[model samples]
Target: MEINHLTAAEARVWRAFARGETVDFRESPDEDPADGGDWGAERTLRAGVLRALLLDGPRQDGEVPSLSVAGARITGRLDLQHATTDHPVRLRNCHFDEAPRCYAARLRELNLSESLLPGLVAHAVHVDGILRMTRTRFTGTVRLGGARIAGSLYLESAQVSAPGTEVPVLQLNQASVGADLSAPGLRTQGQIRLNGATVAGSLNLSDARLGNPEDAALDAQTLTVGGDMLLRHAEVHGWLGLRGARITGRLDLSYVLLSNPGGSALQASSTAVGELWLRKAPPMEGTLNLRRAQLDVLFLEPDSLPQEVLIGDLTYTSLVPHEPAERRLPMLERQRDGYVPHAYEQLTAAYRRVGDDHAARLVQLAKQRRHRNTLPWYGRLWGLVQDVTVGYGFRPMRAAGWLLSLLAIGSVAFALHHPQPLKAGEAPPFHPVFYTLDLLLPVISFGQEDAFAPSGGYQALAYVLVLTGWILATTVIAGVTRTVSRQ
Candidate 1:
């Protein structure tokens, strides 16, 4: 602390505090703090007075007052820029004419909890201890850009209302917190921006009301949190964006009611979370976009899936479903229309990554079935044929089975019929079984079926074998082409 002499006016306010006087900033004693401090006769003290009291007040040997100034109206701006003070300043229930400018200020601790003010501007401020502003009402924007706090930021039940549309009620841009950003039960008219922020502890937003409808309720882009980001049981009337964020712990949205029309309710693209939980939550009103996210675990509840969701390149390590894959896969469709192949692919890939091959196959099979159901009647028929014959171009063994069955039947029919010898042929006697082989394989001829004559059911059956062989051969070629192309 730098030692400094106080100005005459500064000394008067200092002496008054030392003498235990009630400094009244309010014009009328009848007005409540909820009136937004508009009718206040503020007593503006110079910055030097505060600096002097913090520097020399303790050494005055109990001469300084307890710094209690309840219902006081602080006029002008209380500038604490770049001043490092160890003493705690707590002005409870006070009204400020202008916002307290604490930019680049280092403080031991601060408690303005339950006070009515225009706003709070605390850019680049570092507090060694807690910064409490709980239950306070702000008529303007509370900007905390680039702040570094050593302890928790308590704002539980705080009401921050920004006048204009799309303006942020509370801004914590690029701020670094050592502990939680506790703001449970907070009511705000504008969005809460926490872009580029880093929190060492959890972010408690339980039971809070956030943002106007269709606007971003909470903007947390590039935020890195060491602990959980809890939004459980909260009501968000707008979008909750967490793009490019990294949560080392769980990101809980349990029982949260999110509503954003036309756009996504939750846009968490490129975010990496330990667990992306949505258990017991009401179905989100808008799209729950999870594009390019890396989630270690996904915990979803029954009938609680959002009305629409689009997941592209989303990777999860596990899916905790209470039902079997057969039942679960059918109900997991979140797209409003058309089949999304990536949805199935993502699920299959996640199961495969966890070494659950059975689960992966089950999801893949369900994917094929559902995909076919979305097609036209003709398309569905074609899909069925492909599935039955070659398992959607994935089972060549089934094609082999069909060919072998036809070949065996052809051989038996020719042997029972006993075809007559050819009139003009160098091969003396026509062997019935060998003749059947010639007709079956279109690509190869053994010079027997070409030279023999067969009567009765033998002739009709031989033609059938030829046609069936052509169909199987063509399908095999088509399936092989499709399989190779897909790879």
Candidate 2:
């Protein structure tokens, strides 16, 4: 880089690179360019000059060779692909004519905070320190895929817009970050993908508004995070897919407003998390899928559940807010993917683990009813009988009620109609209550039942009483056996 070819702004940046001082091009120290406009030659620098200074700048014994320029308008492309630099680059509040391409470049810290750029393509780049892009605005896609960062990646309050594109505006696919990917208050018009990305620390996206209504707003399939993934108060217009993701800590989505009508609002199938916080979130417009997801603790509310939920094989060890079966059973019933027995069984186990036996029985009874709907007609009819009589062996009191009612009917009928004796004087007295009791108790003879023979309507009543007694007895035995076997 010759001194004669360098412009005034580039010359100043060149002089300040080794001194570790920022070259502020604003009219005053406190002046901030609102839209990064109204810049003349005094605030203009060729990107090639900046790149040359970073690559081959003069360094002193104790000075760190860094490029810190603010409020400058960079022209041309800053292509540093496959390049290596030991300097920390900080281009704050700068405007660029072309997007900076640092693909496969290895550097120290790179901070572009509050800058206005066309885009950034740093795919496969290795950053030794933090990659800060806080408050920056990008008009095109910011591709950081396959990048390995030793420190955290900050995108707080950054806005990226790339409409009418099938690709994501912000792509971090397969990137490995040693620290957190903190992006609170981040707004994007297109999808933000983190597919197959591995973060050693937490991924915080609190209060982000991701807008991709026709498709997925955020696709993080197969993402592995060592710490918590916080998306609290975030609003996603399209489906937020987290299929096969594994988070070591909690995945908090409290107070989120997801809208993906006619599709799934959140798909976390096969995801495993330590804790899942979905409390106080409004009912989503689409399905909340948790098929095969495993969680240690689930902080959810029945009223906050979406209309269509796909919790086919979701297993949670503990549920917060500790609601009863009446409130939680509806969540299992709302699964539109037909009858899932595992869902009911999981809820039953969850209740039972907490020593809520009554709630567990209620959930088990609901499981029978849901399973009955999938059976054949005859099986369903038999199930209905079991349900109405004894709640499919879960409500034993119903059997007792039926038995007492039948006993009362038989006693009253025999009290009204007296039967004739089979023999003239060898027959015992026809005591109605005793005779009815004898007729109702199968395999038991009270001697009066054998001595007296009923005629006409009285004979028909005895036959009905005997048949009812057998049915009630068999049902009671079957129900009690089933209940005891379960225990």
Candidate 3:
């Protein structure tokens, strides 16, 4: 219950300002300056008086401000808890001793450009217009959690630095904004959390510097954004987490410099987006983990792909350049620990989903070839032999091709036999094709192999055909088993 004291000249300034009239430090322009000698001294205003004026003041449409108090430093905390106002609060280059706690307050617009504030607590506060804080410096944490904003929120070139190390500098958890959230050229120390927040327009953070070496710098878990999240040409020392987010537009991180060293730079697990743009000149340098992400278009250049990035379980519908199976080689080649089965499988499935079975088989073939090359010398030899005979279970028709070739060669040898007789002459079913099939197949009995009695080279060739049948049949069985296990 502290009372605010005002001087005689300051009393006149407040009366004129509340009446929608203009007044300088001394008096009106018609009054003489010699009437007030101490008007040249600097003025100090209490926080309670500023809060009262904001609640009771009426804004007239003119060149004059609604409540313009220049060169005055606020003493106590301006607690406008749940107060509703319609006028715009414009405070320029002023200093606040404590943070203005406008919790659940309904405001029209707030323009604190070039001001120095300790912090700001506007949780669940409704604003119909923009919250402009251009070039302002916030020494403490600014929590705008659950706030609803109709217009844009501009923090252009602002500096928000908290005293602690691990906590977030700006908290916007569950906050909903209708327009853009432009924080270009902003320099912040701790993390900027936007967990479960919804932004209707774009979030342009281009050319900003976010540094938090201990942990993630921007934790935007489950954030639903209507437009782009532009971090182009920005620099982040910590991680960028967007796990389970739904972005309507592109997540543009082109030319963004991020370094988290051993940890993940961007963990976008289960995120659904229209397009993911990482087509930078030098590419991103950190470990980008995009597991379980579904994107319509993913634009990635060959040179820009990082050596340690991972896209396991990621499914993209349309890749650029039309031929994605061949064009996506650089990304798979850049894996750190070599072959990842899910990455290749996901890409192959995407191509198959688009009705490109030819490209899908090519991707499967490429995955096997690249994986075999990374194996040891003995393993590579075994893999190559399996591929030549059976196509690594990817082509079961190759095993059929081998069986048909052997059957044709053996059929020609037996068809030109010198002496071929039937057993007991009981109307023998001995033909070239039926006898060859009996020799190739182990289970089927066409009574042609036992009925025919061969001599000279035919008998010796029959022994080779019997062994070749088992080998080809075993190869086919092995190929089928391998395919079943993979599925």
Candidate 4:
């Protein structure tokens, strides 16, 4: 494989490479410097017709030092398939107006660091190592679908602007990364899809901005992150869907702002997080649906502003119901009987912060259900009285008091009607002893007539005294019993 100069047709290929069009070129052996050094060794073409071109061939090992396509306006397709190089390939400030396809192009490293391209269609583009794109601007849609690489894919501070002529911005379908996906300060105009993608390391999306409101900003379905999924400070104008995604470590969405109106702001349903710290997320119009999601511990630290942290019907059961007695310390622990009530209380507080009175009331009712069996003593007593008043259609306490007062009055009337005879010899029309025997037992006996017998008026007075004492004793006993029962 000797070094060859660019012919008329080959010069056209060289011109396409200069214009930033996709090209597949084969490698050629470098001429010995000891010799007059093949003057046409380096490939060069004048910049003009920027269109799609493919350059492919076999090159001598260690021939080309670098593939430099510096400044040109290349439009249409560009494919650099299976091209080997020792040093970095630089495409610095070239303008690619159309789609530039680079499939299976092997290079030491591709540095499109500060290039202006409308769209980059690089499918299965294999770099020998990393592909660094720092501050590169993509004016139109960019697709890297089904690309595989052994090293990291760094896109730090890359801006993906929406096309002015009604076109989508970026799509990363089924792209796998062996290392971290550091897209910090990544701005996308249309939907960014990472469905069915696998990242061996962390997926850092800090300070990323998704500008599309109607379309989903981050569709990360079934994505598996080997490390933590850091989305801190990420602003999504649309929904951030992480449905069925699995994060091996903590999922930190601390200060993420999700402002989607129609759909849920954050749909992490069926996703698993080792630990979730959603401390201060931006206000969302819709619910943050996390139903059926599992977490080791969900932290809800207090925030400066009053924020409502809605925890949807989450089923959280303690892994260890009973800790060792020696390890247990007395703190504000939620007991078995109090777990449901405490959870309900927390839910109520959250809803109340957002001024959702209906939700708060619903939670309160659920709490009441938890304590249904254990009513306060006073409450139970009040309920009993009400039931008695309504059930039997009789106020028993009021009726009993009225009947007792009437019996006392009748006794007094009888005593006044039939006054005891002054003379005992003239037998009294009625022997008062029968009625007075039970009442006046302490004062008199039957056997001792002389000592037992008193004047008739005095006997009447004794009867009155006995009756008053008996009534007072019964009333006091009844009052004491009622008080003890209530307590």
Q: Compare the candidates by lDDT and give the number of the best one.
A: 2
RMSD of 2: 1.7
Ranked candidates, highest lDDT first? 2, 3, 1, 4
| Count of backbone clashes, every candidate in sequence | 1, 0, 0, 15
Task: Put down candidate 2 lDDT per residue, 306-388, tens digits, no spaces.
Answer: 88899998999998889989999889889989899899988888888889999999998888888999999998988888888
RMSD of 4: 16.0
On residues 225-332, what C-alpha lDDT tens digit does candidate 3 reach at each position? 999988888888889999999999998888888777778888898999988887664655477788789999887666566567777778887665455567776677
Q: lDDT of each model, Cα atoms only?
A: 0.77, 0.89, 0.77, 0.56
Question: What residue runs in model 3 are displaced by over 4 Å at the alpha carbon?
Answer: 1-16, 19-44, 58-65, 69-72, 281-285, 309-312, 321-342, 352-359, 366-384, 393-487
Stretches of candidate 2 exceeding 4 Å from the true structure: 28-34, 443-445
**Residue-by-residue lDDT tens digits, candidate 4, 217-255:** 888888888988887888888888888888888787778
- What pairs collide in candidate 3? none
Local accuracy of candidate 1 as per-residue lDDT tens digits, 70-164: 55556667778887776667766666777888889998888787788888888899999989888888888898989999999999999999787
Would you give me the overall lDDT of model 1?
A: 0.77
Which candidate's TM-score is highest?
2
